[model samples]
Target: MAGKRRKVPHALHSELSEYSSLLRALSTNDTLDVAKRLTESKPRKRKKRTEEESDGAAENEGTAAPSKKRRKRTEDAPVDAESTQNEAAGSSQLPEEEPNGDKPKRVRKRDGWTRWPLLVTDLRVPEFGLDEEIEALVRHCLRNNNPHPTDEDGDSDPEDDAPAWLPHLTQSSSAFLSSLFALLAHHTPARPQVMQDRLNAIDWRMVLDILATCGSVDADVINTVKTRMEAIYGPYDGPAPTRLEARAVAKSRTDAALDEADDAMFVAVRPSKRLPKRVLEDVDSDALDD
Candidate 1:
């Protein structure tokens, strides 16, 4: 089943609101606003001679300390661009703003396991505990540094490296597995597979058969996942292959070994005959005490 495609959204509704507010603030800073900002600094320097010169001098550090500080702040803090001028303006008239020396509060995730850092703990399950190395693989997925389709040098570019995190905060430690292999461990054991491997693993005829009977998932979601799987890896060639099992055999393994031992040998006396002529294996005549 083919899923109806929709255009991708660059940002979410919640993010758009914040971005809109920031844009309004930025857009308002026009030629006159720039002129006012430039002219405003010099007056502040002269204002140091005022009655409150000692206190005012601190505000007159940078030619325009507030704007400079705000730009510097972007490295460590979320620029509250909506609170554009008045917040970081650093002017004495604006009530000397306190320095935000602290780093920006990171956006934590609801699942308790964060995606931003892509920790193995995010995928934690009981089959495997939190492994720190999974974070690197998650990072590799998030890296958008893949070469452009048109680039002649695309083939030459080596893999990229970078970090991004949106950590889940609500994860329980012992309750669940923190590993990707947890789900399919018994059979399919999900992990990175090249396209050809994916093709081999999947049995498309079985997919259609199961899809007809699968009632748990919405048809749309099933289509979406199926389409995504097909797009990433070519379709499977055959239906699921049969898995052969060993025939049942009695008296195997531990019980068999124990039953074979002379001291622990299993003896069966028939009810009809009561006891056989030789009730058990004949004892070694020479070894037995006379």
Candidate 2:
């Protein structure tokens, strides 16, 4: 009986098979679309936890575990901190050491005449016994060709004409020499060895030249004057003259000239044009009345 009833449902069976096939195609397309989306889309990534967050999470783990990890992290961190401190300290000290090693040292040369301290010391003779000797020297130099007589009663007796201190004169001469040396030394630039050799070679010719150009002397008189200067100031090697030394020399010369002028004979007149006669008379009359 069941087999005979099923023969009447053929159209219904065919229609159901066609609908099942359409549903299977739609399901296959949907699966293909999902596969394409999976291939094209970027993967979702888990973010890395910061140190603080990781430490907090670790702290939330048991107390024993967190304390051990924290101690290890602290030990590792100190090495970096110490290295940073050393770098900072080294950078700070670098500039200070650089100057000491790299900077040049400056040395000043001594003044010209000061280099002849020995000569100056020798010339600083006693003041009392040398007055006459100094006066004779001066008279000899100033008298031109005339012979300077020794006795006070001589024809040139000029009783007031007496010699002054020689040390004072020597001191002035030394100062002038020092200044001249300083001037020349300072102006000329040569190696110390060369300069010393040159100064050592200085002789009558150099002296004559100095006297001819700078000193108050004629070319013919320079030879004699050079000999006199050599007798006074000996050889020296030091720096050349400076402005200050030059000025000092000039002052010494001026002072010596003034001293000589003061020593020279000068007539003093008792004010010949005395206060007018009337003024004097009035003063005398007033005094007499009183």
Candidate 3:
């Protein structure tokens, strides 16, 4: 009975072979279906193979000899698109740093000249006594009507007829006058326009008095101050008296006095050659008595 069991093909043998083939075909089809499903998925899962597993697989496949284990490429790893774009936008919007490291500085403007205050100390007269002399001269010139008195014949005024109160400046006084004039000549246009403007804004009489008192020792100095004052006050050609014109008048009077003195000296030293015979006779008579 055991020998027959081994030799005789049972009716179930064909069915069993068919079942085995079908099972193999089904496994292959199932494997193919799994692969297709994986490809069609929206999000794909990457296969994670260990280094040893990959190397062993490659050896079994008869490919090139396995190399050293490679480090994963994290630098180029896939990132969320929205997150990456948000990061980039945030970095771009950051404010830049200033190279100077601080806020910018500001500049201020200067005030005009008229803003400066005057002090009482600046009003004191100089120690040279020039202020008194200049004041006297100015007063005399303004008050005295006849600086030079003419004879009835309209001839040159006699030496005695000259004004009594004419300004007779000393050598020191003359030097001061020259210096004042020089100062005026040099600084008339050089002084800042603002200073002139300030001067003009003040009362003319007060300004003139201040200048005259401050610069009395020298004519030149006085003139310089006057020139500055005039420039501010607009050319002072009006009936109002000016230092420049006063200086000129004073100079003329001085020259005339000098000329008269010279004439008197000449007359005293050199008697007239054409004197009358009677006058000569009287002189000879007196000489004989001496």
Q: Rank the candidates by TM-score, best first.
A: 2, 3, 1
Writing each residue's lDDT as its tens digit, candidate 1 over 196-285 gives 222122233444334334232244554566567576446744322111011112224556667578554556646775664756877798
Indicate which candidate wins on TM-score.
Answer: 2
The true-versus-predicted C-alpha distance at residue 204 of model 1, in Å, is 8.6
lDDT of each: 0.42, 0.52, 0.51
Candidate 3 shows a clash count of 9
Q: Arrange candidates by lDDT, highest first: which order?
A: 2, 3, 1
Model 2 over residues 78-184: C-alpha lDDT tens digits? 65777768867986887532212322345597433212112222233435644455556666675654465556546555435544655578666666656776654
lDDT at residue 113 of model 3 (Cα atoms) = 30
Q: Evaluate residue 288 in candidate 2 and report its C-alpha lDDT on the 0 to 100 scale.
A: 72
The alpha-carbon lDDT assigned to residue 185 of candidate 1 equals: 30
